[model samples]
Target: MSSPDRCPVVHFDHHSPEHAADPVGAYRKLRAEHPVAWTEAHGGYWVLSDYESVFEAARDDYTFSSARTSYGGEGLSVTIPKTPMHLHIPIEIDPPDFRKYRKLVNLITAPAAVERMLDMISHYTTWFIDRVIEAGEADFAEIIGVPSIVTIDWLGLPVEEWSRYSSAHRATLSAVADSPEFRQAVEVDLPYLSKQMWEVIAERRLNPADDVISFLVQQQVDDRPLTDEEVFAIVDLLISGGVGTTASLVGQTLVWLYQNPDVRLRIKDDPGLLDRAIEEFLRYFSPTQALARTVTKDVEFRGCPMRTGDRVLLAWGSANRDEAGGFENPDALDIDRWPNRHTAFGVGLHRCAGSHLGRAMARSLIGQILERMPDYEIDLDGLVPYARQGVNIGFHKIPARFTPGPRRLPRDDRSG
Candidate 1:
């Protein structure tokens, strides 16, 4: 499998453990060793990791485009085709077209809106902890994970059925991701999830309330309300995006803290320092790993040639960790890391809309957990079974045990 001209390695299989264990390692190697590498695996595509190359891909929609079409008029399976849910989401669109939807999304997810939900956020954080804090140890996923479903579902989703939707979400990504097994899993679950969303959308329409669903059920766009299908499309994105991604961040970040007591101590002593720490965590431990795009025109990026019709995975995890990539130390978690531009929520036109809410939920949940029960380290073994996979990097399980009695956290101060 000869790659395009001026390329380096020809990775034979995309699902190799080497690719799985440390995805960024492969990308870094590509950036350093093969700035314009091509992989013949998974129906063929290109990997662009050079800092300059990715930046170009993000900005130049004409050369490195977001639309799922190619100037070459070829149907390359390089990128996953957009779904119905994408139509209502400006996140999947580009520029002016994306703005119409993004403005509404931003309005609802604005920082001020986050402040308004502080009481609910605080209450949930405390409520979840109060349930399992006494047990001395509990699975953060099940306790907090299940609760997220409840909170989000009340926001106008049928989240009580997460036991079902969670499986569906995992399966759909698994299908398109690294394995044939996951693809089979998707076959059995995706339709069910879609159907459930349809049913719930219908129910919410007939009977509206003060929740987010009602807000949408009657929301007007230029004096006309959204269609049921459009409403479901947007809500579906939230269903998959909101709860699952936050759970992953909370679980993974906890595990990271558990491994580094020094870091944990830093959080324990200066609770206020948590806000900055959470930002750095999102940068270093970006939950969303990669987003794919179909190249729409011929272009040369980072000095490597790109074809008109090809698939490119903007491996964010790799970009965030790149040593030469103009951010702070990509490898370490510096609580005071400022001017951080890691693309955890992505860059350019498709930036994540739910990010404010995501950060708020994660910060509040993690802060409250350590605030009340500071000495518990996480359990990684149990998470193996239910941890879902997708572009969003996440964990399936996190078990933490309190070190018994009045857990001591770092006080108002600690040396950085």
Candidate 2:
């Protein structure tokens, strides 16, 4: 056995282009060799690559704290090198305190709320699809990125500035961590978006509207109206959570479907199978890659000694592909696979609160794409995936071509 003081270590760069291109293969190798390996990247940390370990760690909040500033006097920001502007609510806070903030935003993304947005989602999806249906070619990311912004706008932000905020959000997703572009997004773009949200908050306070911003402004916590900071935090969380990730899923799903015509035909023939197919896609291509948790106590997990203040990465993508994690033929795309308990939306208390919204958006968008542009073919040579795949895996561009189709919208409806 390896000495407890000197555990086996491996140098795995999760952010490299090679890993980003084929994260599943990279993680599969790691899972086979070192299911719990210590990496030297980002000032050294433990990486849990197997499903059992990752799931367990996510559940044990006491052992693996989610706080950016943990009780052990160390910052446990989810991203490596840490984010410059790190004030994401609920996700960044631990239990007891996490419950209040989570409750505030839960209703916004609950099933009923998301169900109500379906007609709006379908409208926006059709509107965007109509723009490219007659073009014969378009970048799928650019085409699909707008609807989420429109959804957020309806939720009580400025719809007119959707382009600006959406661009900022997309830039942040595509850029490498701490890069100039990423830094600009964090320091400049996000603050500007926050300012806009604050203005909306001010307006909602006086002239309340039937929107999320107005609802948030009127919400009380502990017998007091939620403070400006709390409200801002919630809105920021909504903007960040709702914008790019759903688009990424839809875009990536398109890329996958275009490549696998057999699976595409299966879903196309049987529309009822699309939901299960979406779940399989989520399991296969876990968009939000790995989330960080700080070790709160000294513990020996899988023979690796974890000290307090140590940051451990729970590789959710790896867990979804684990062969022993309850799924048969883990790597294969089995759309009919039932009881898929994948960690695509994460697990335990911090499972993505926007899961309902994300699912609805993805289903609505992809369904519209299949219906309108069923013959669309991806330009394999023109595909461009994001360079970094640590926090979020998404496409920079996915160019595609299709037979020209008639515009679904009337000329009057086209004029925005």
lDDT by residue (tens digit), candidate 1, 1-416 = 45556355466233455565566566667666775677766556666665566666777655555653543233322233322223335544556665666676676778887777766676656656666665788877665553355446446655456556655554444234435645544555556767766776788789886567677777766568878876776676666666666777777788888888898888888888887888788878777766667776677766657676767767666677776667756777787888777777777777777778887788788887777778887766655533223255655557678854432223332111
Write one digit per residue (lDDT tens) for candidate 2, span 227-269.
7777877777677677877878888899989998987887777
Q: Which ten residues in a row have the lowest lDDT in candidate 1?
A: 407-416
For residue 151, what is the lDDT in candidate 1?
Answer: 42
Q: TM-score for candidate 2, please give it.
A: 0.94
Q: Can you give the TM-score per candidate against the true fold?
A: 0.84, 0.94
Clashes of 2: 0
State the lDDT at 117 in candidate 2.
78
lDDT of 2: 0.81
Root-mean-square deviation of Cα positions for candidate 1 versus the true structure, in angstroms: 6.0
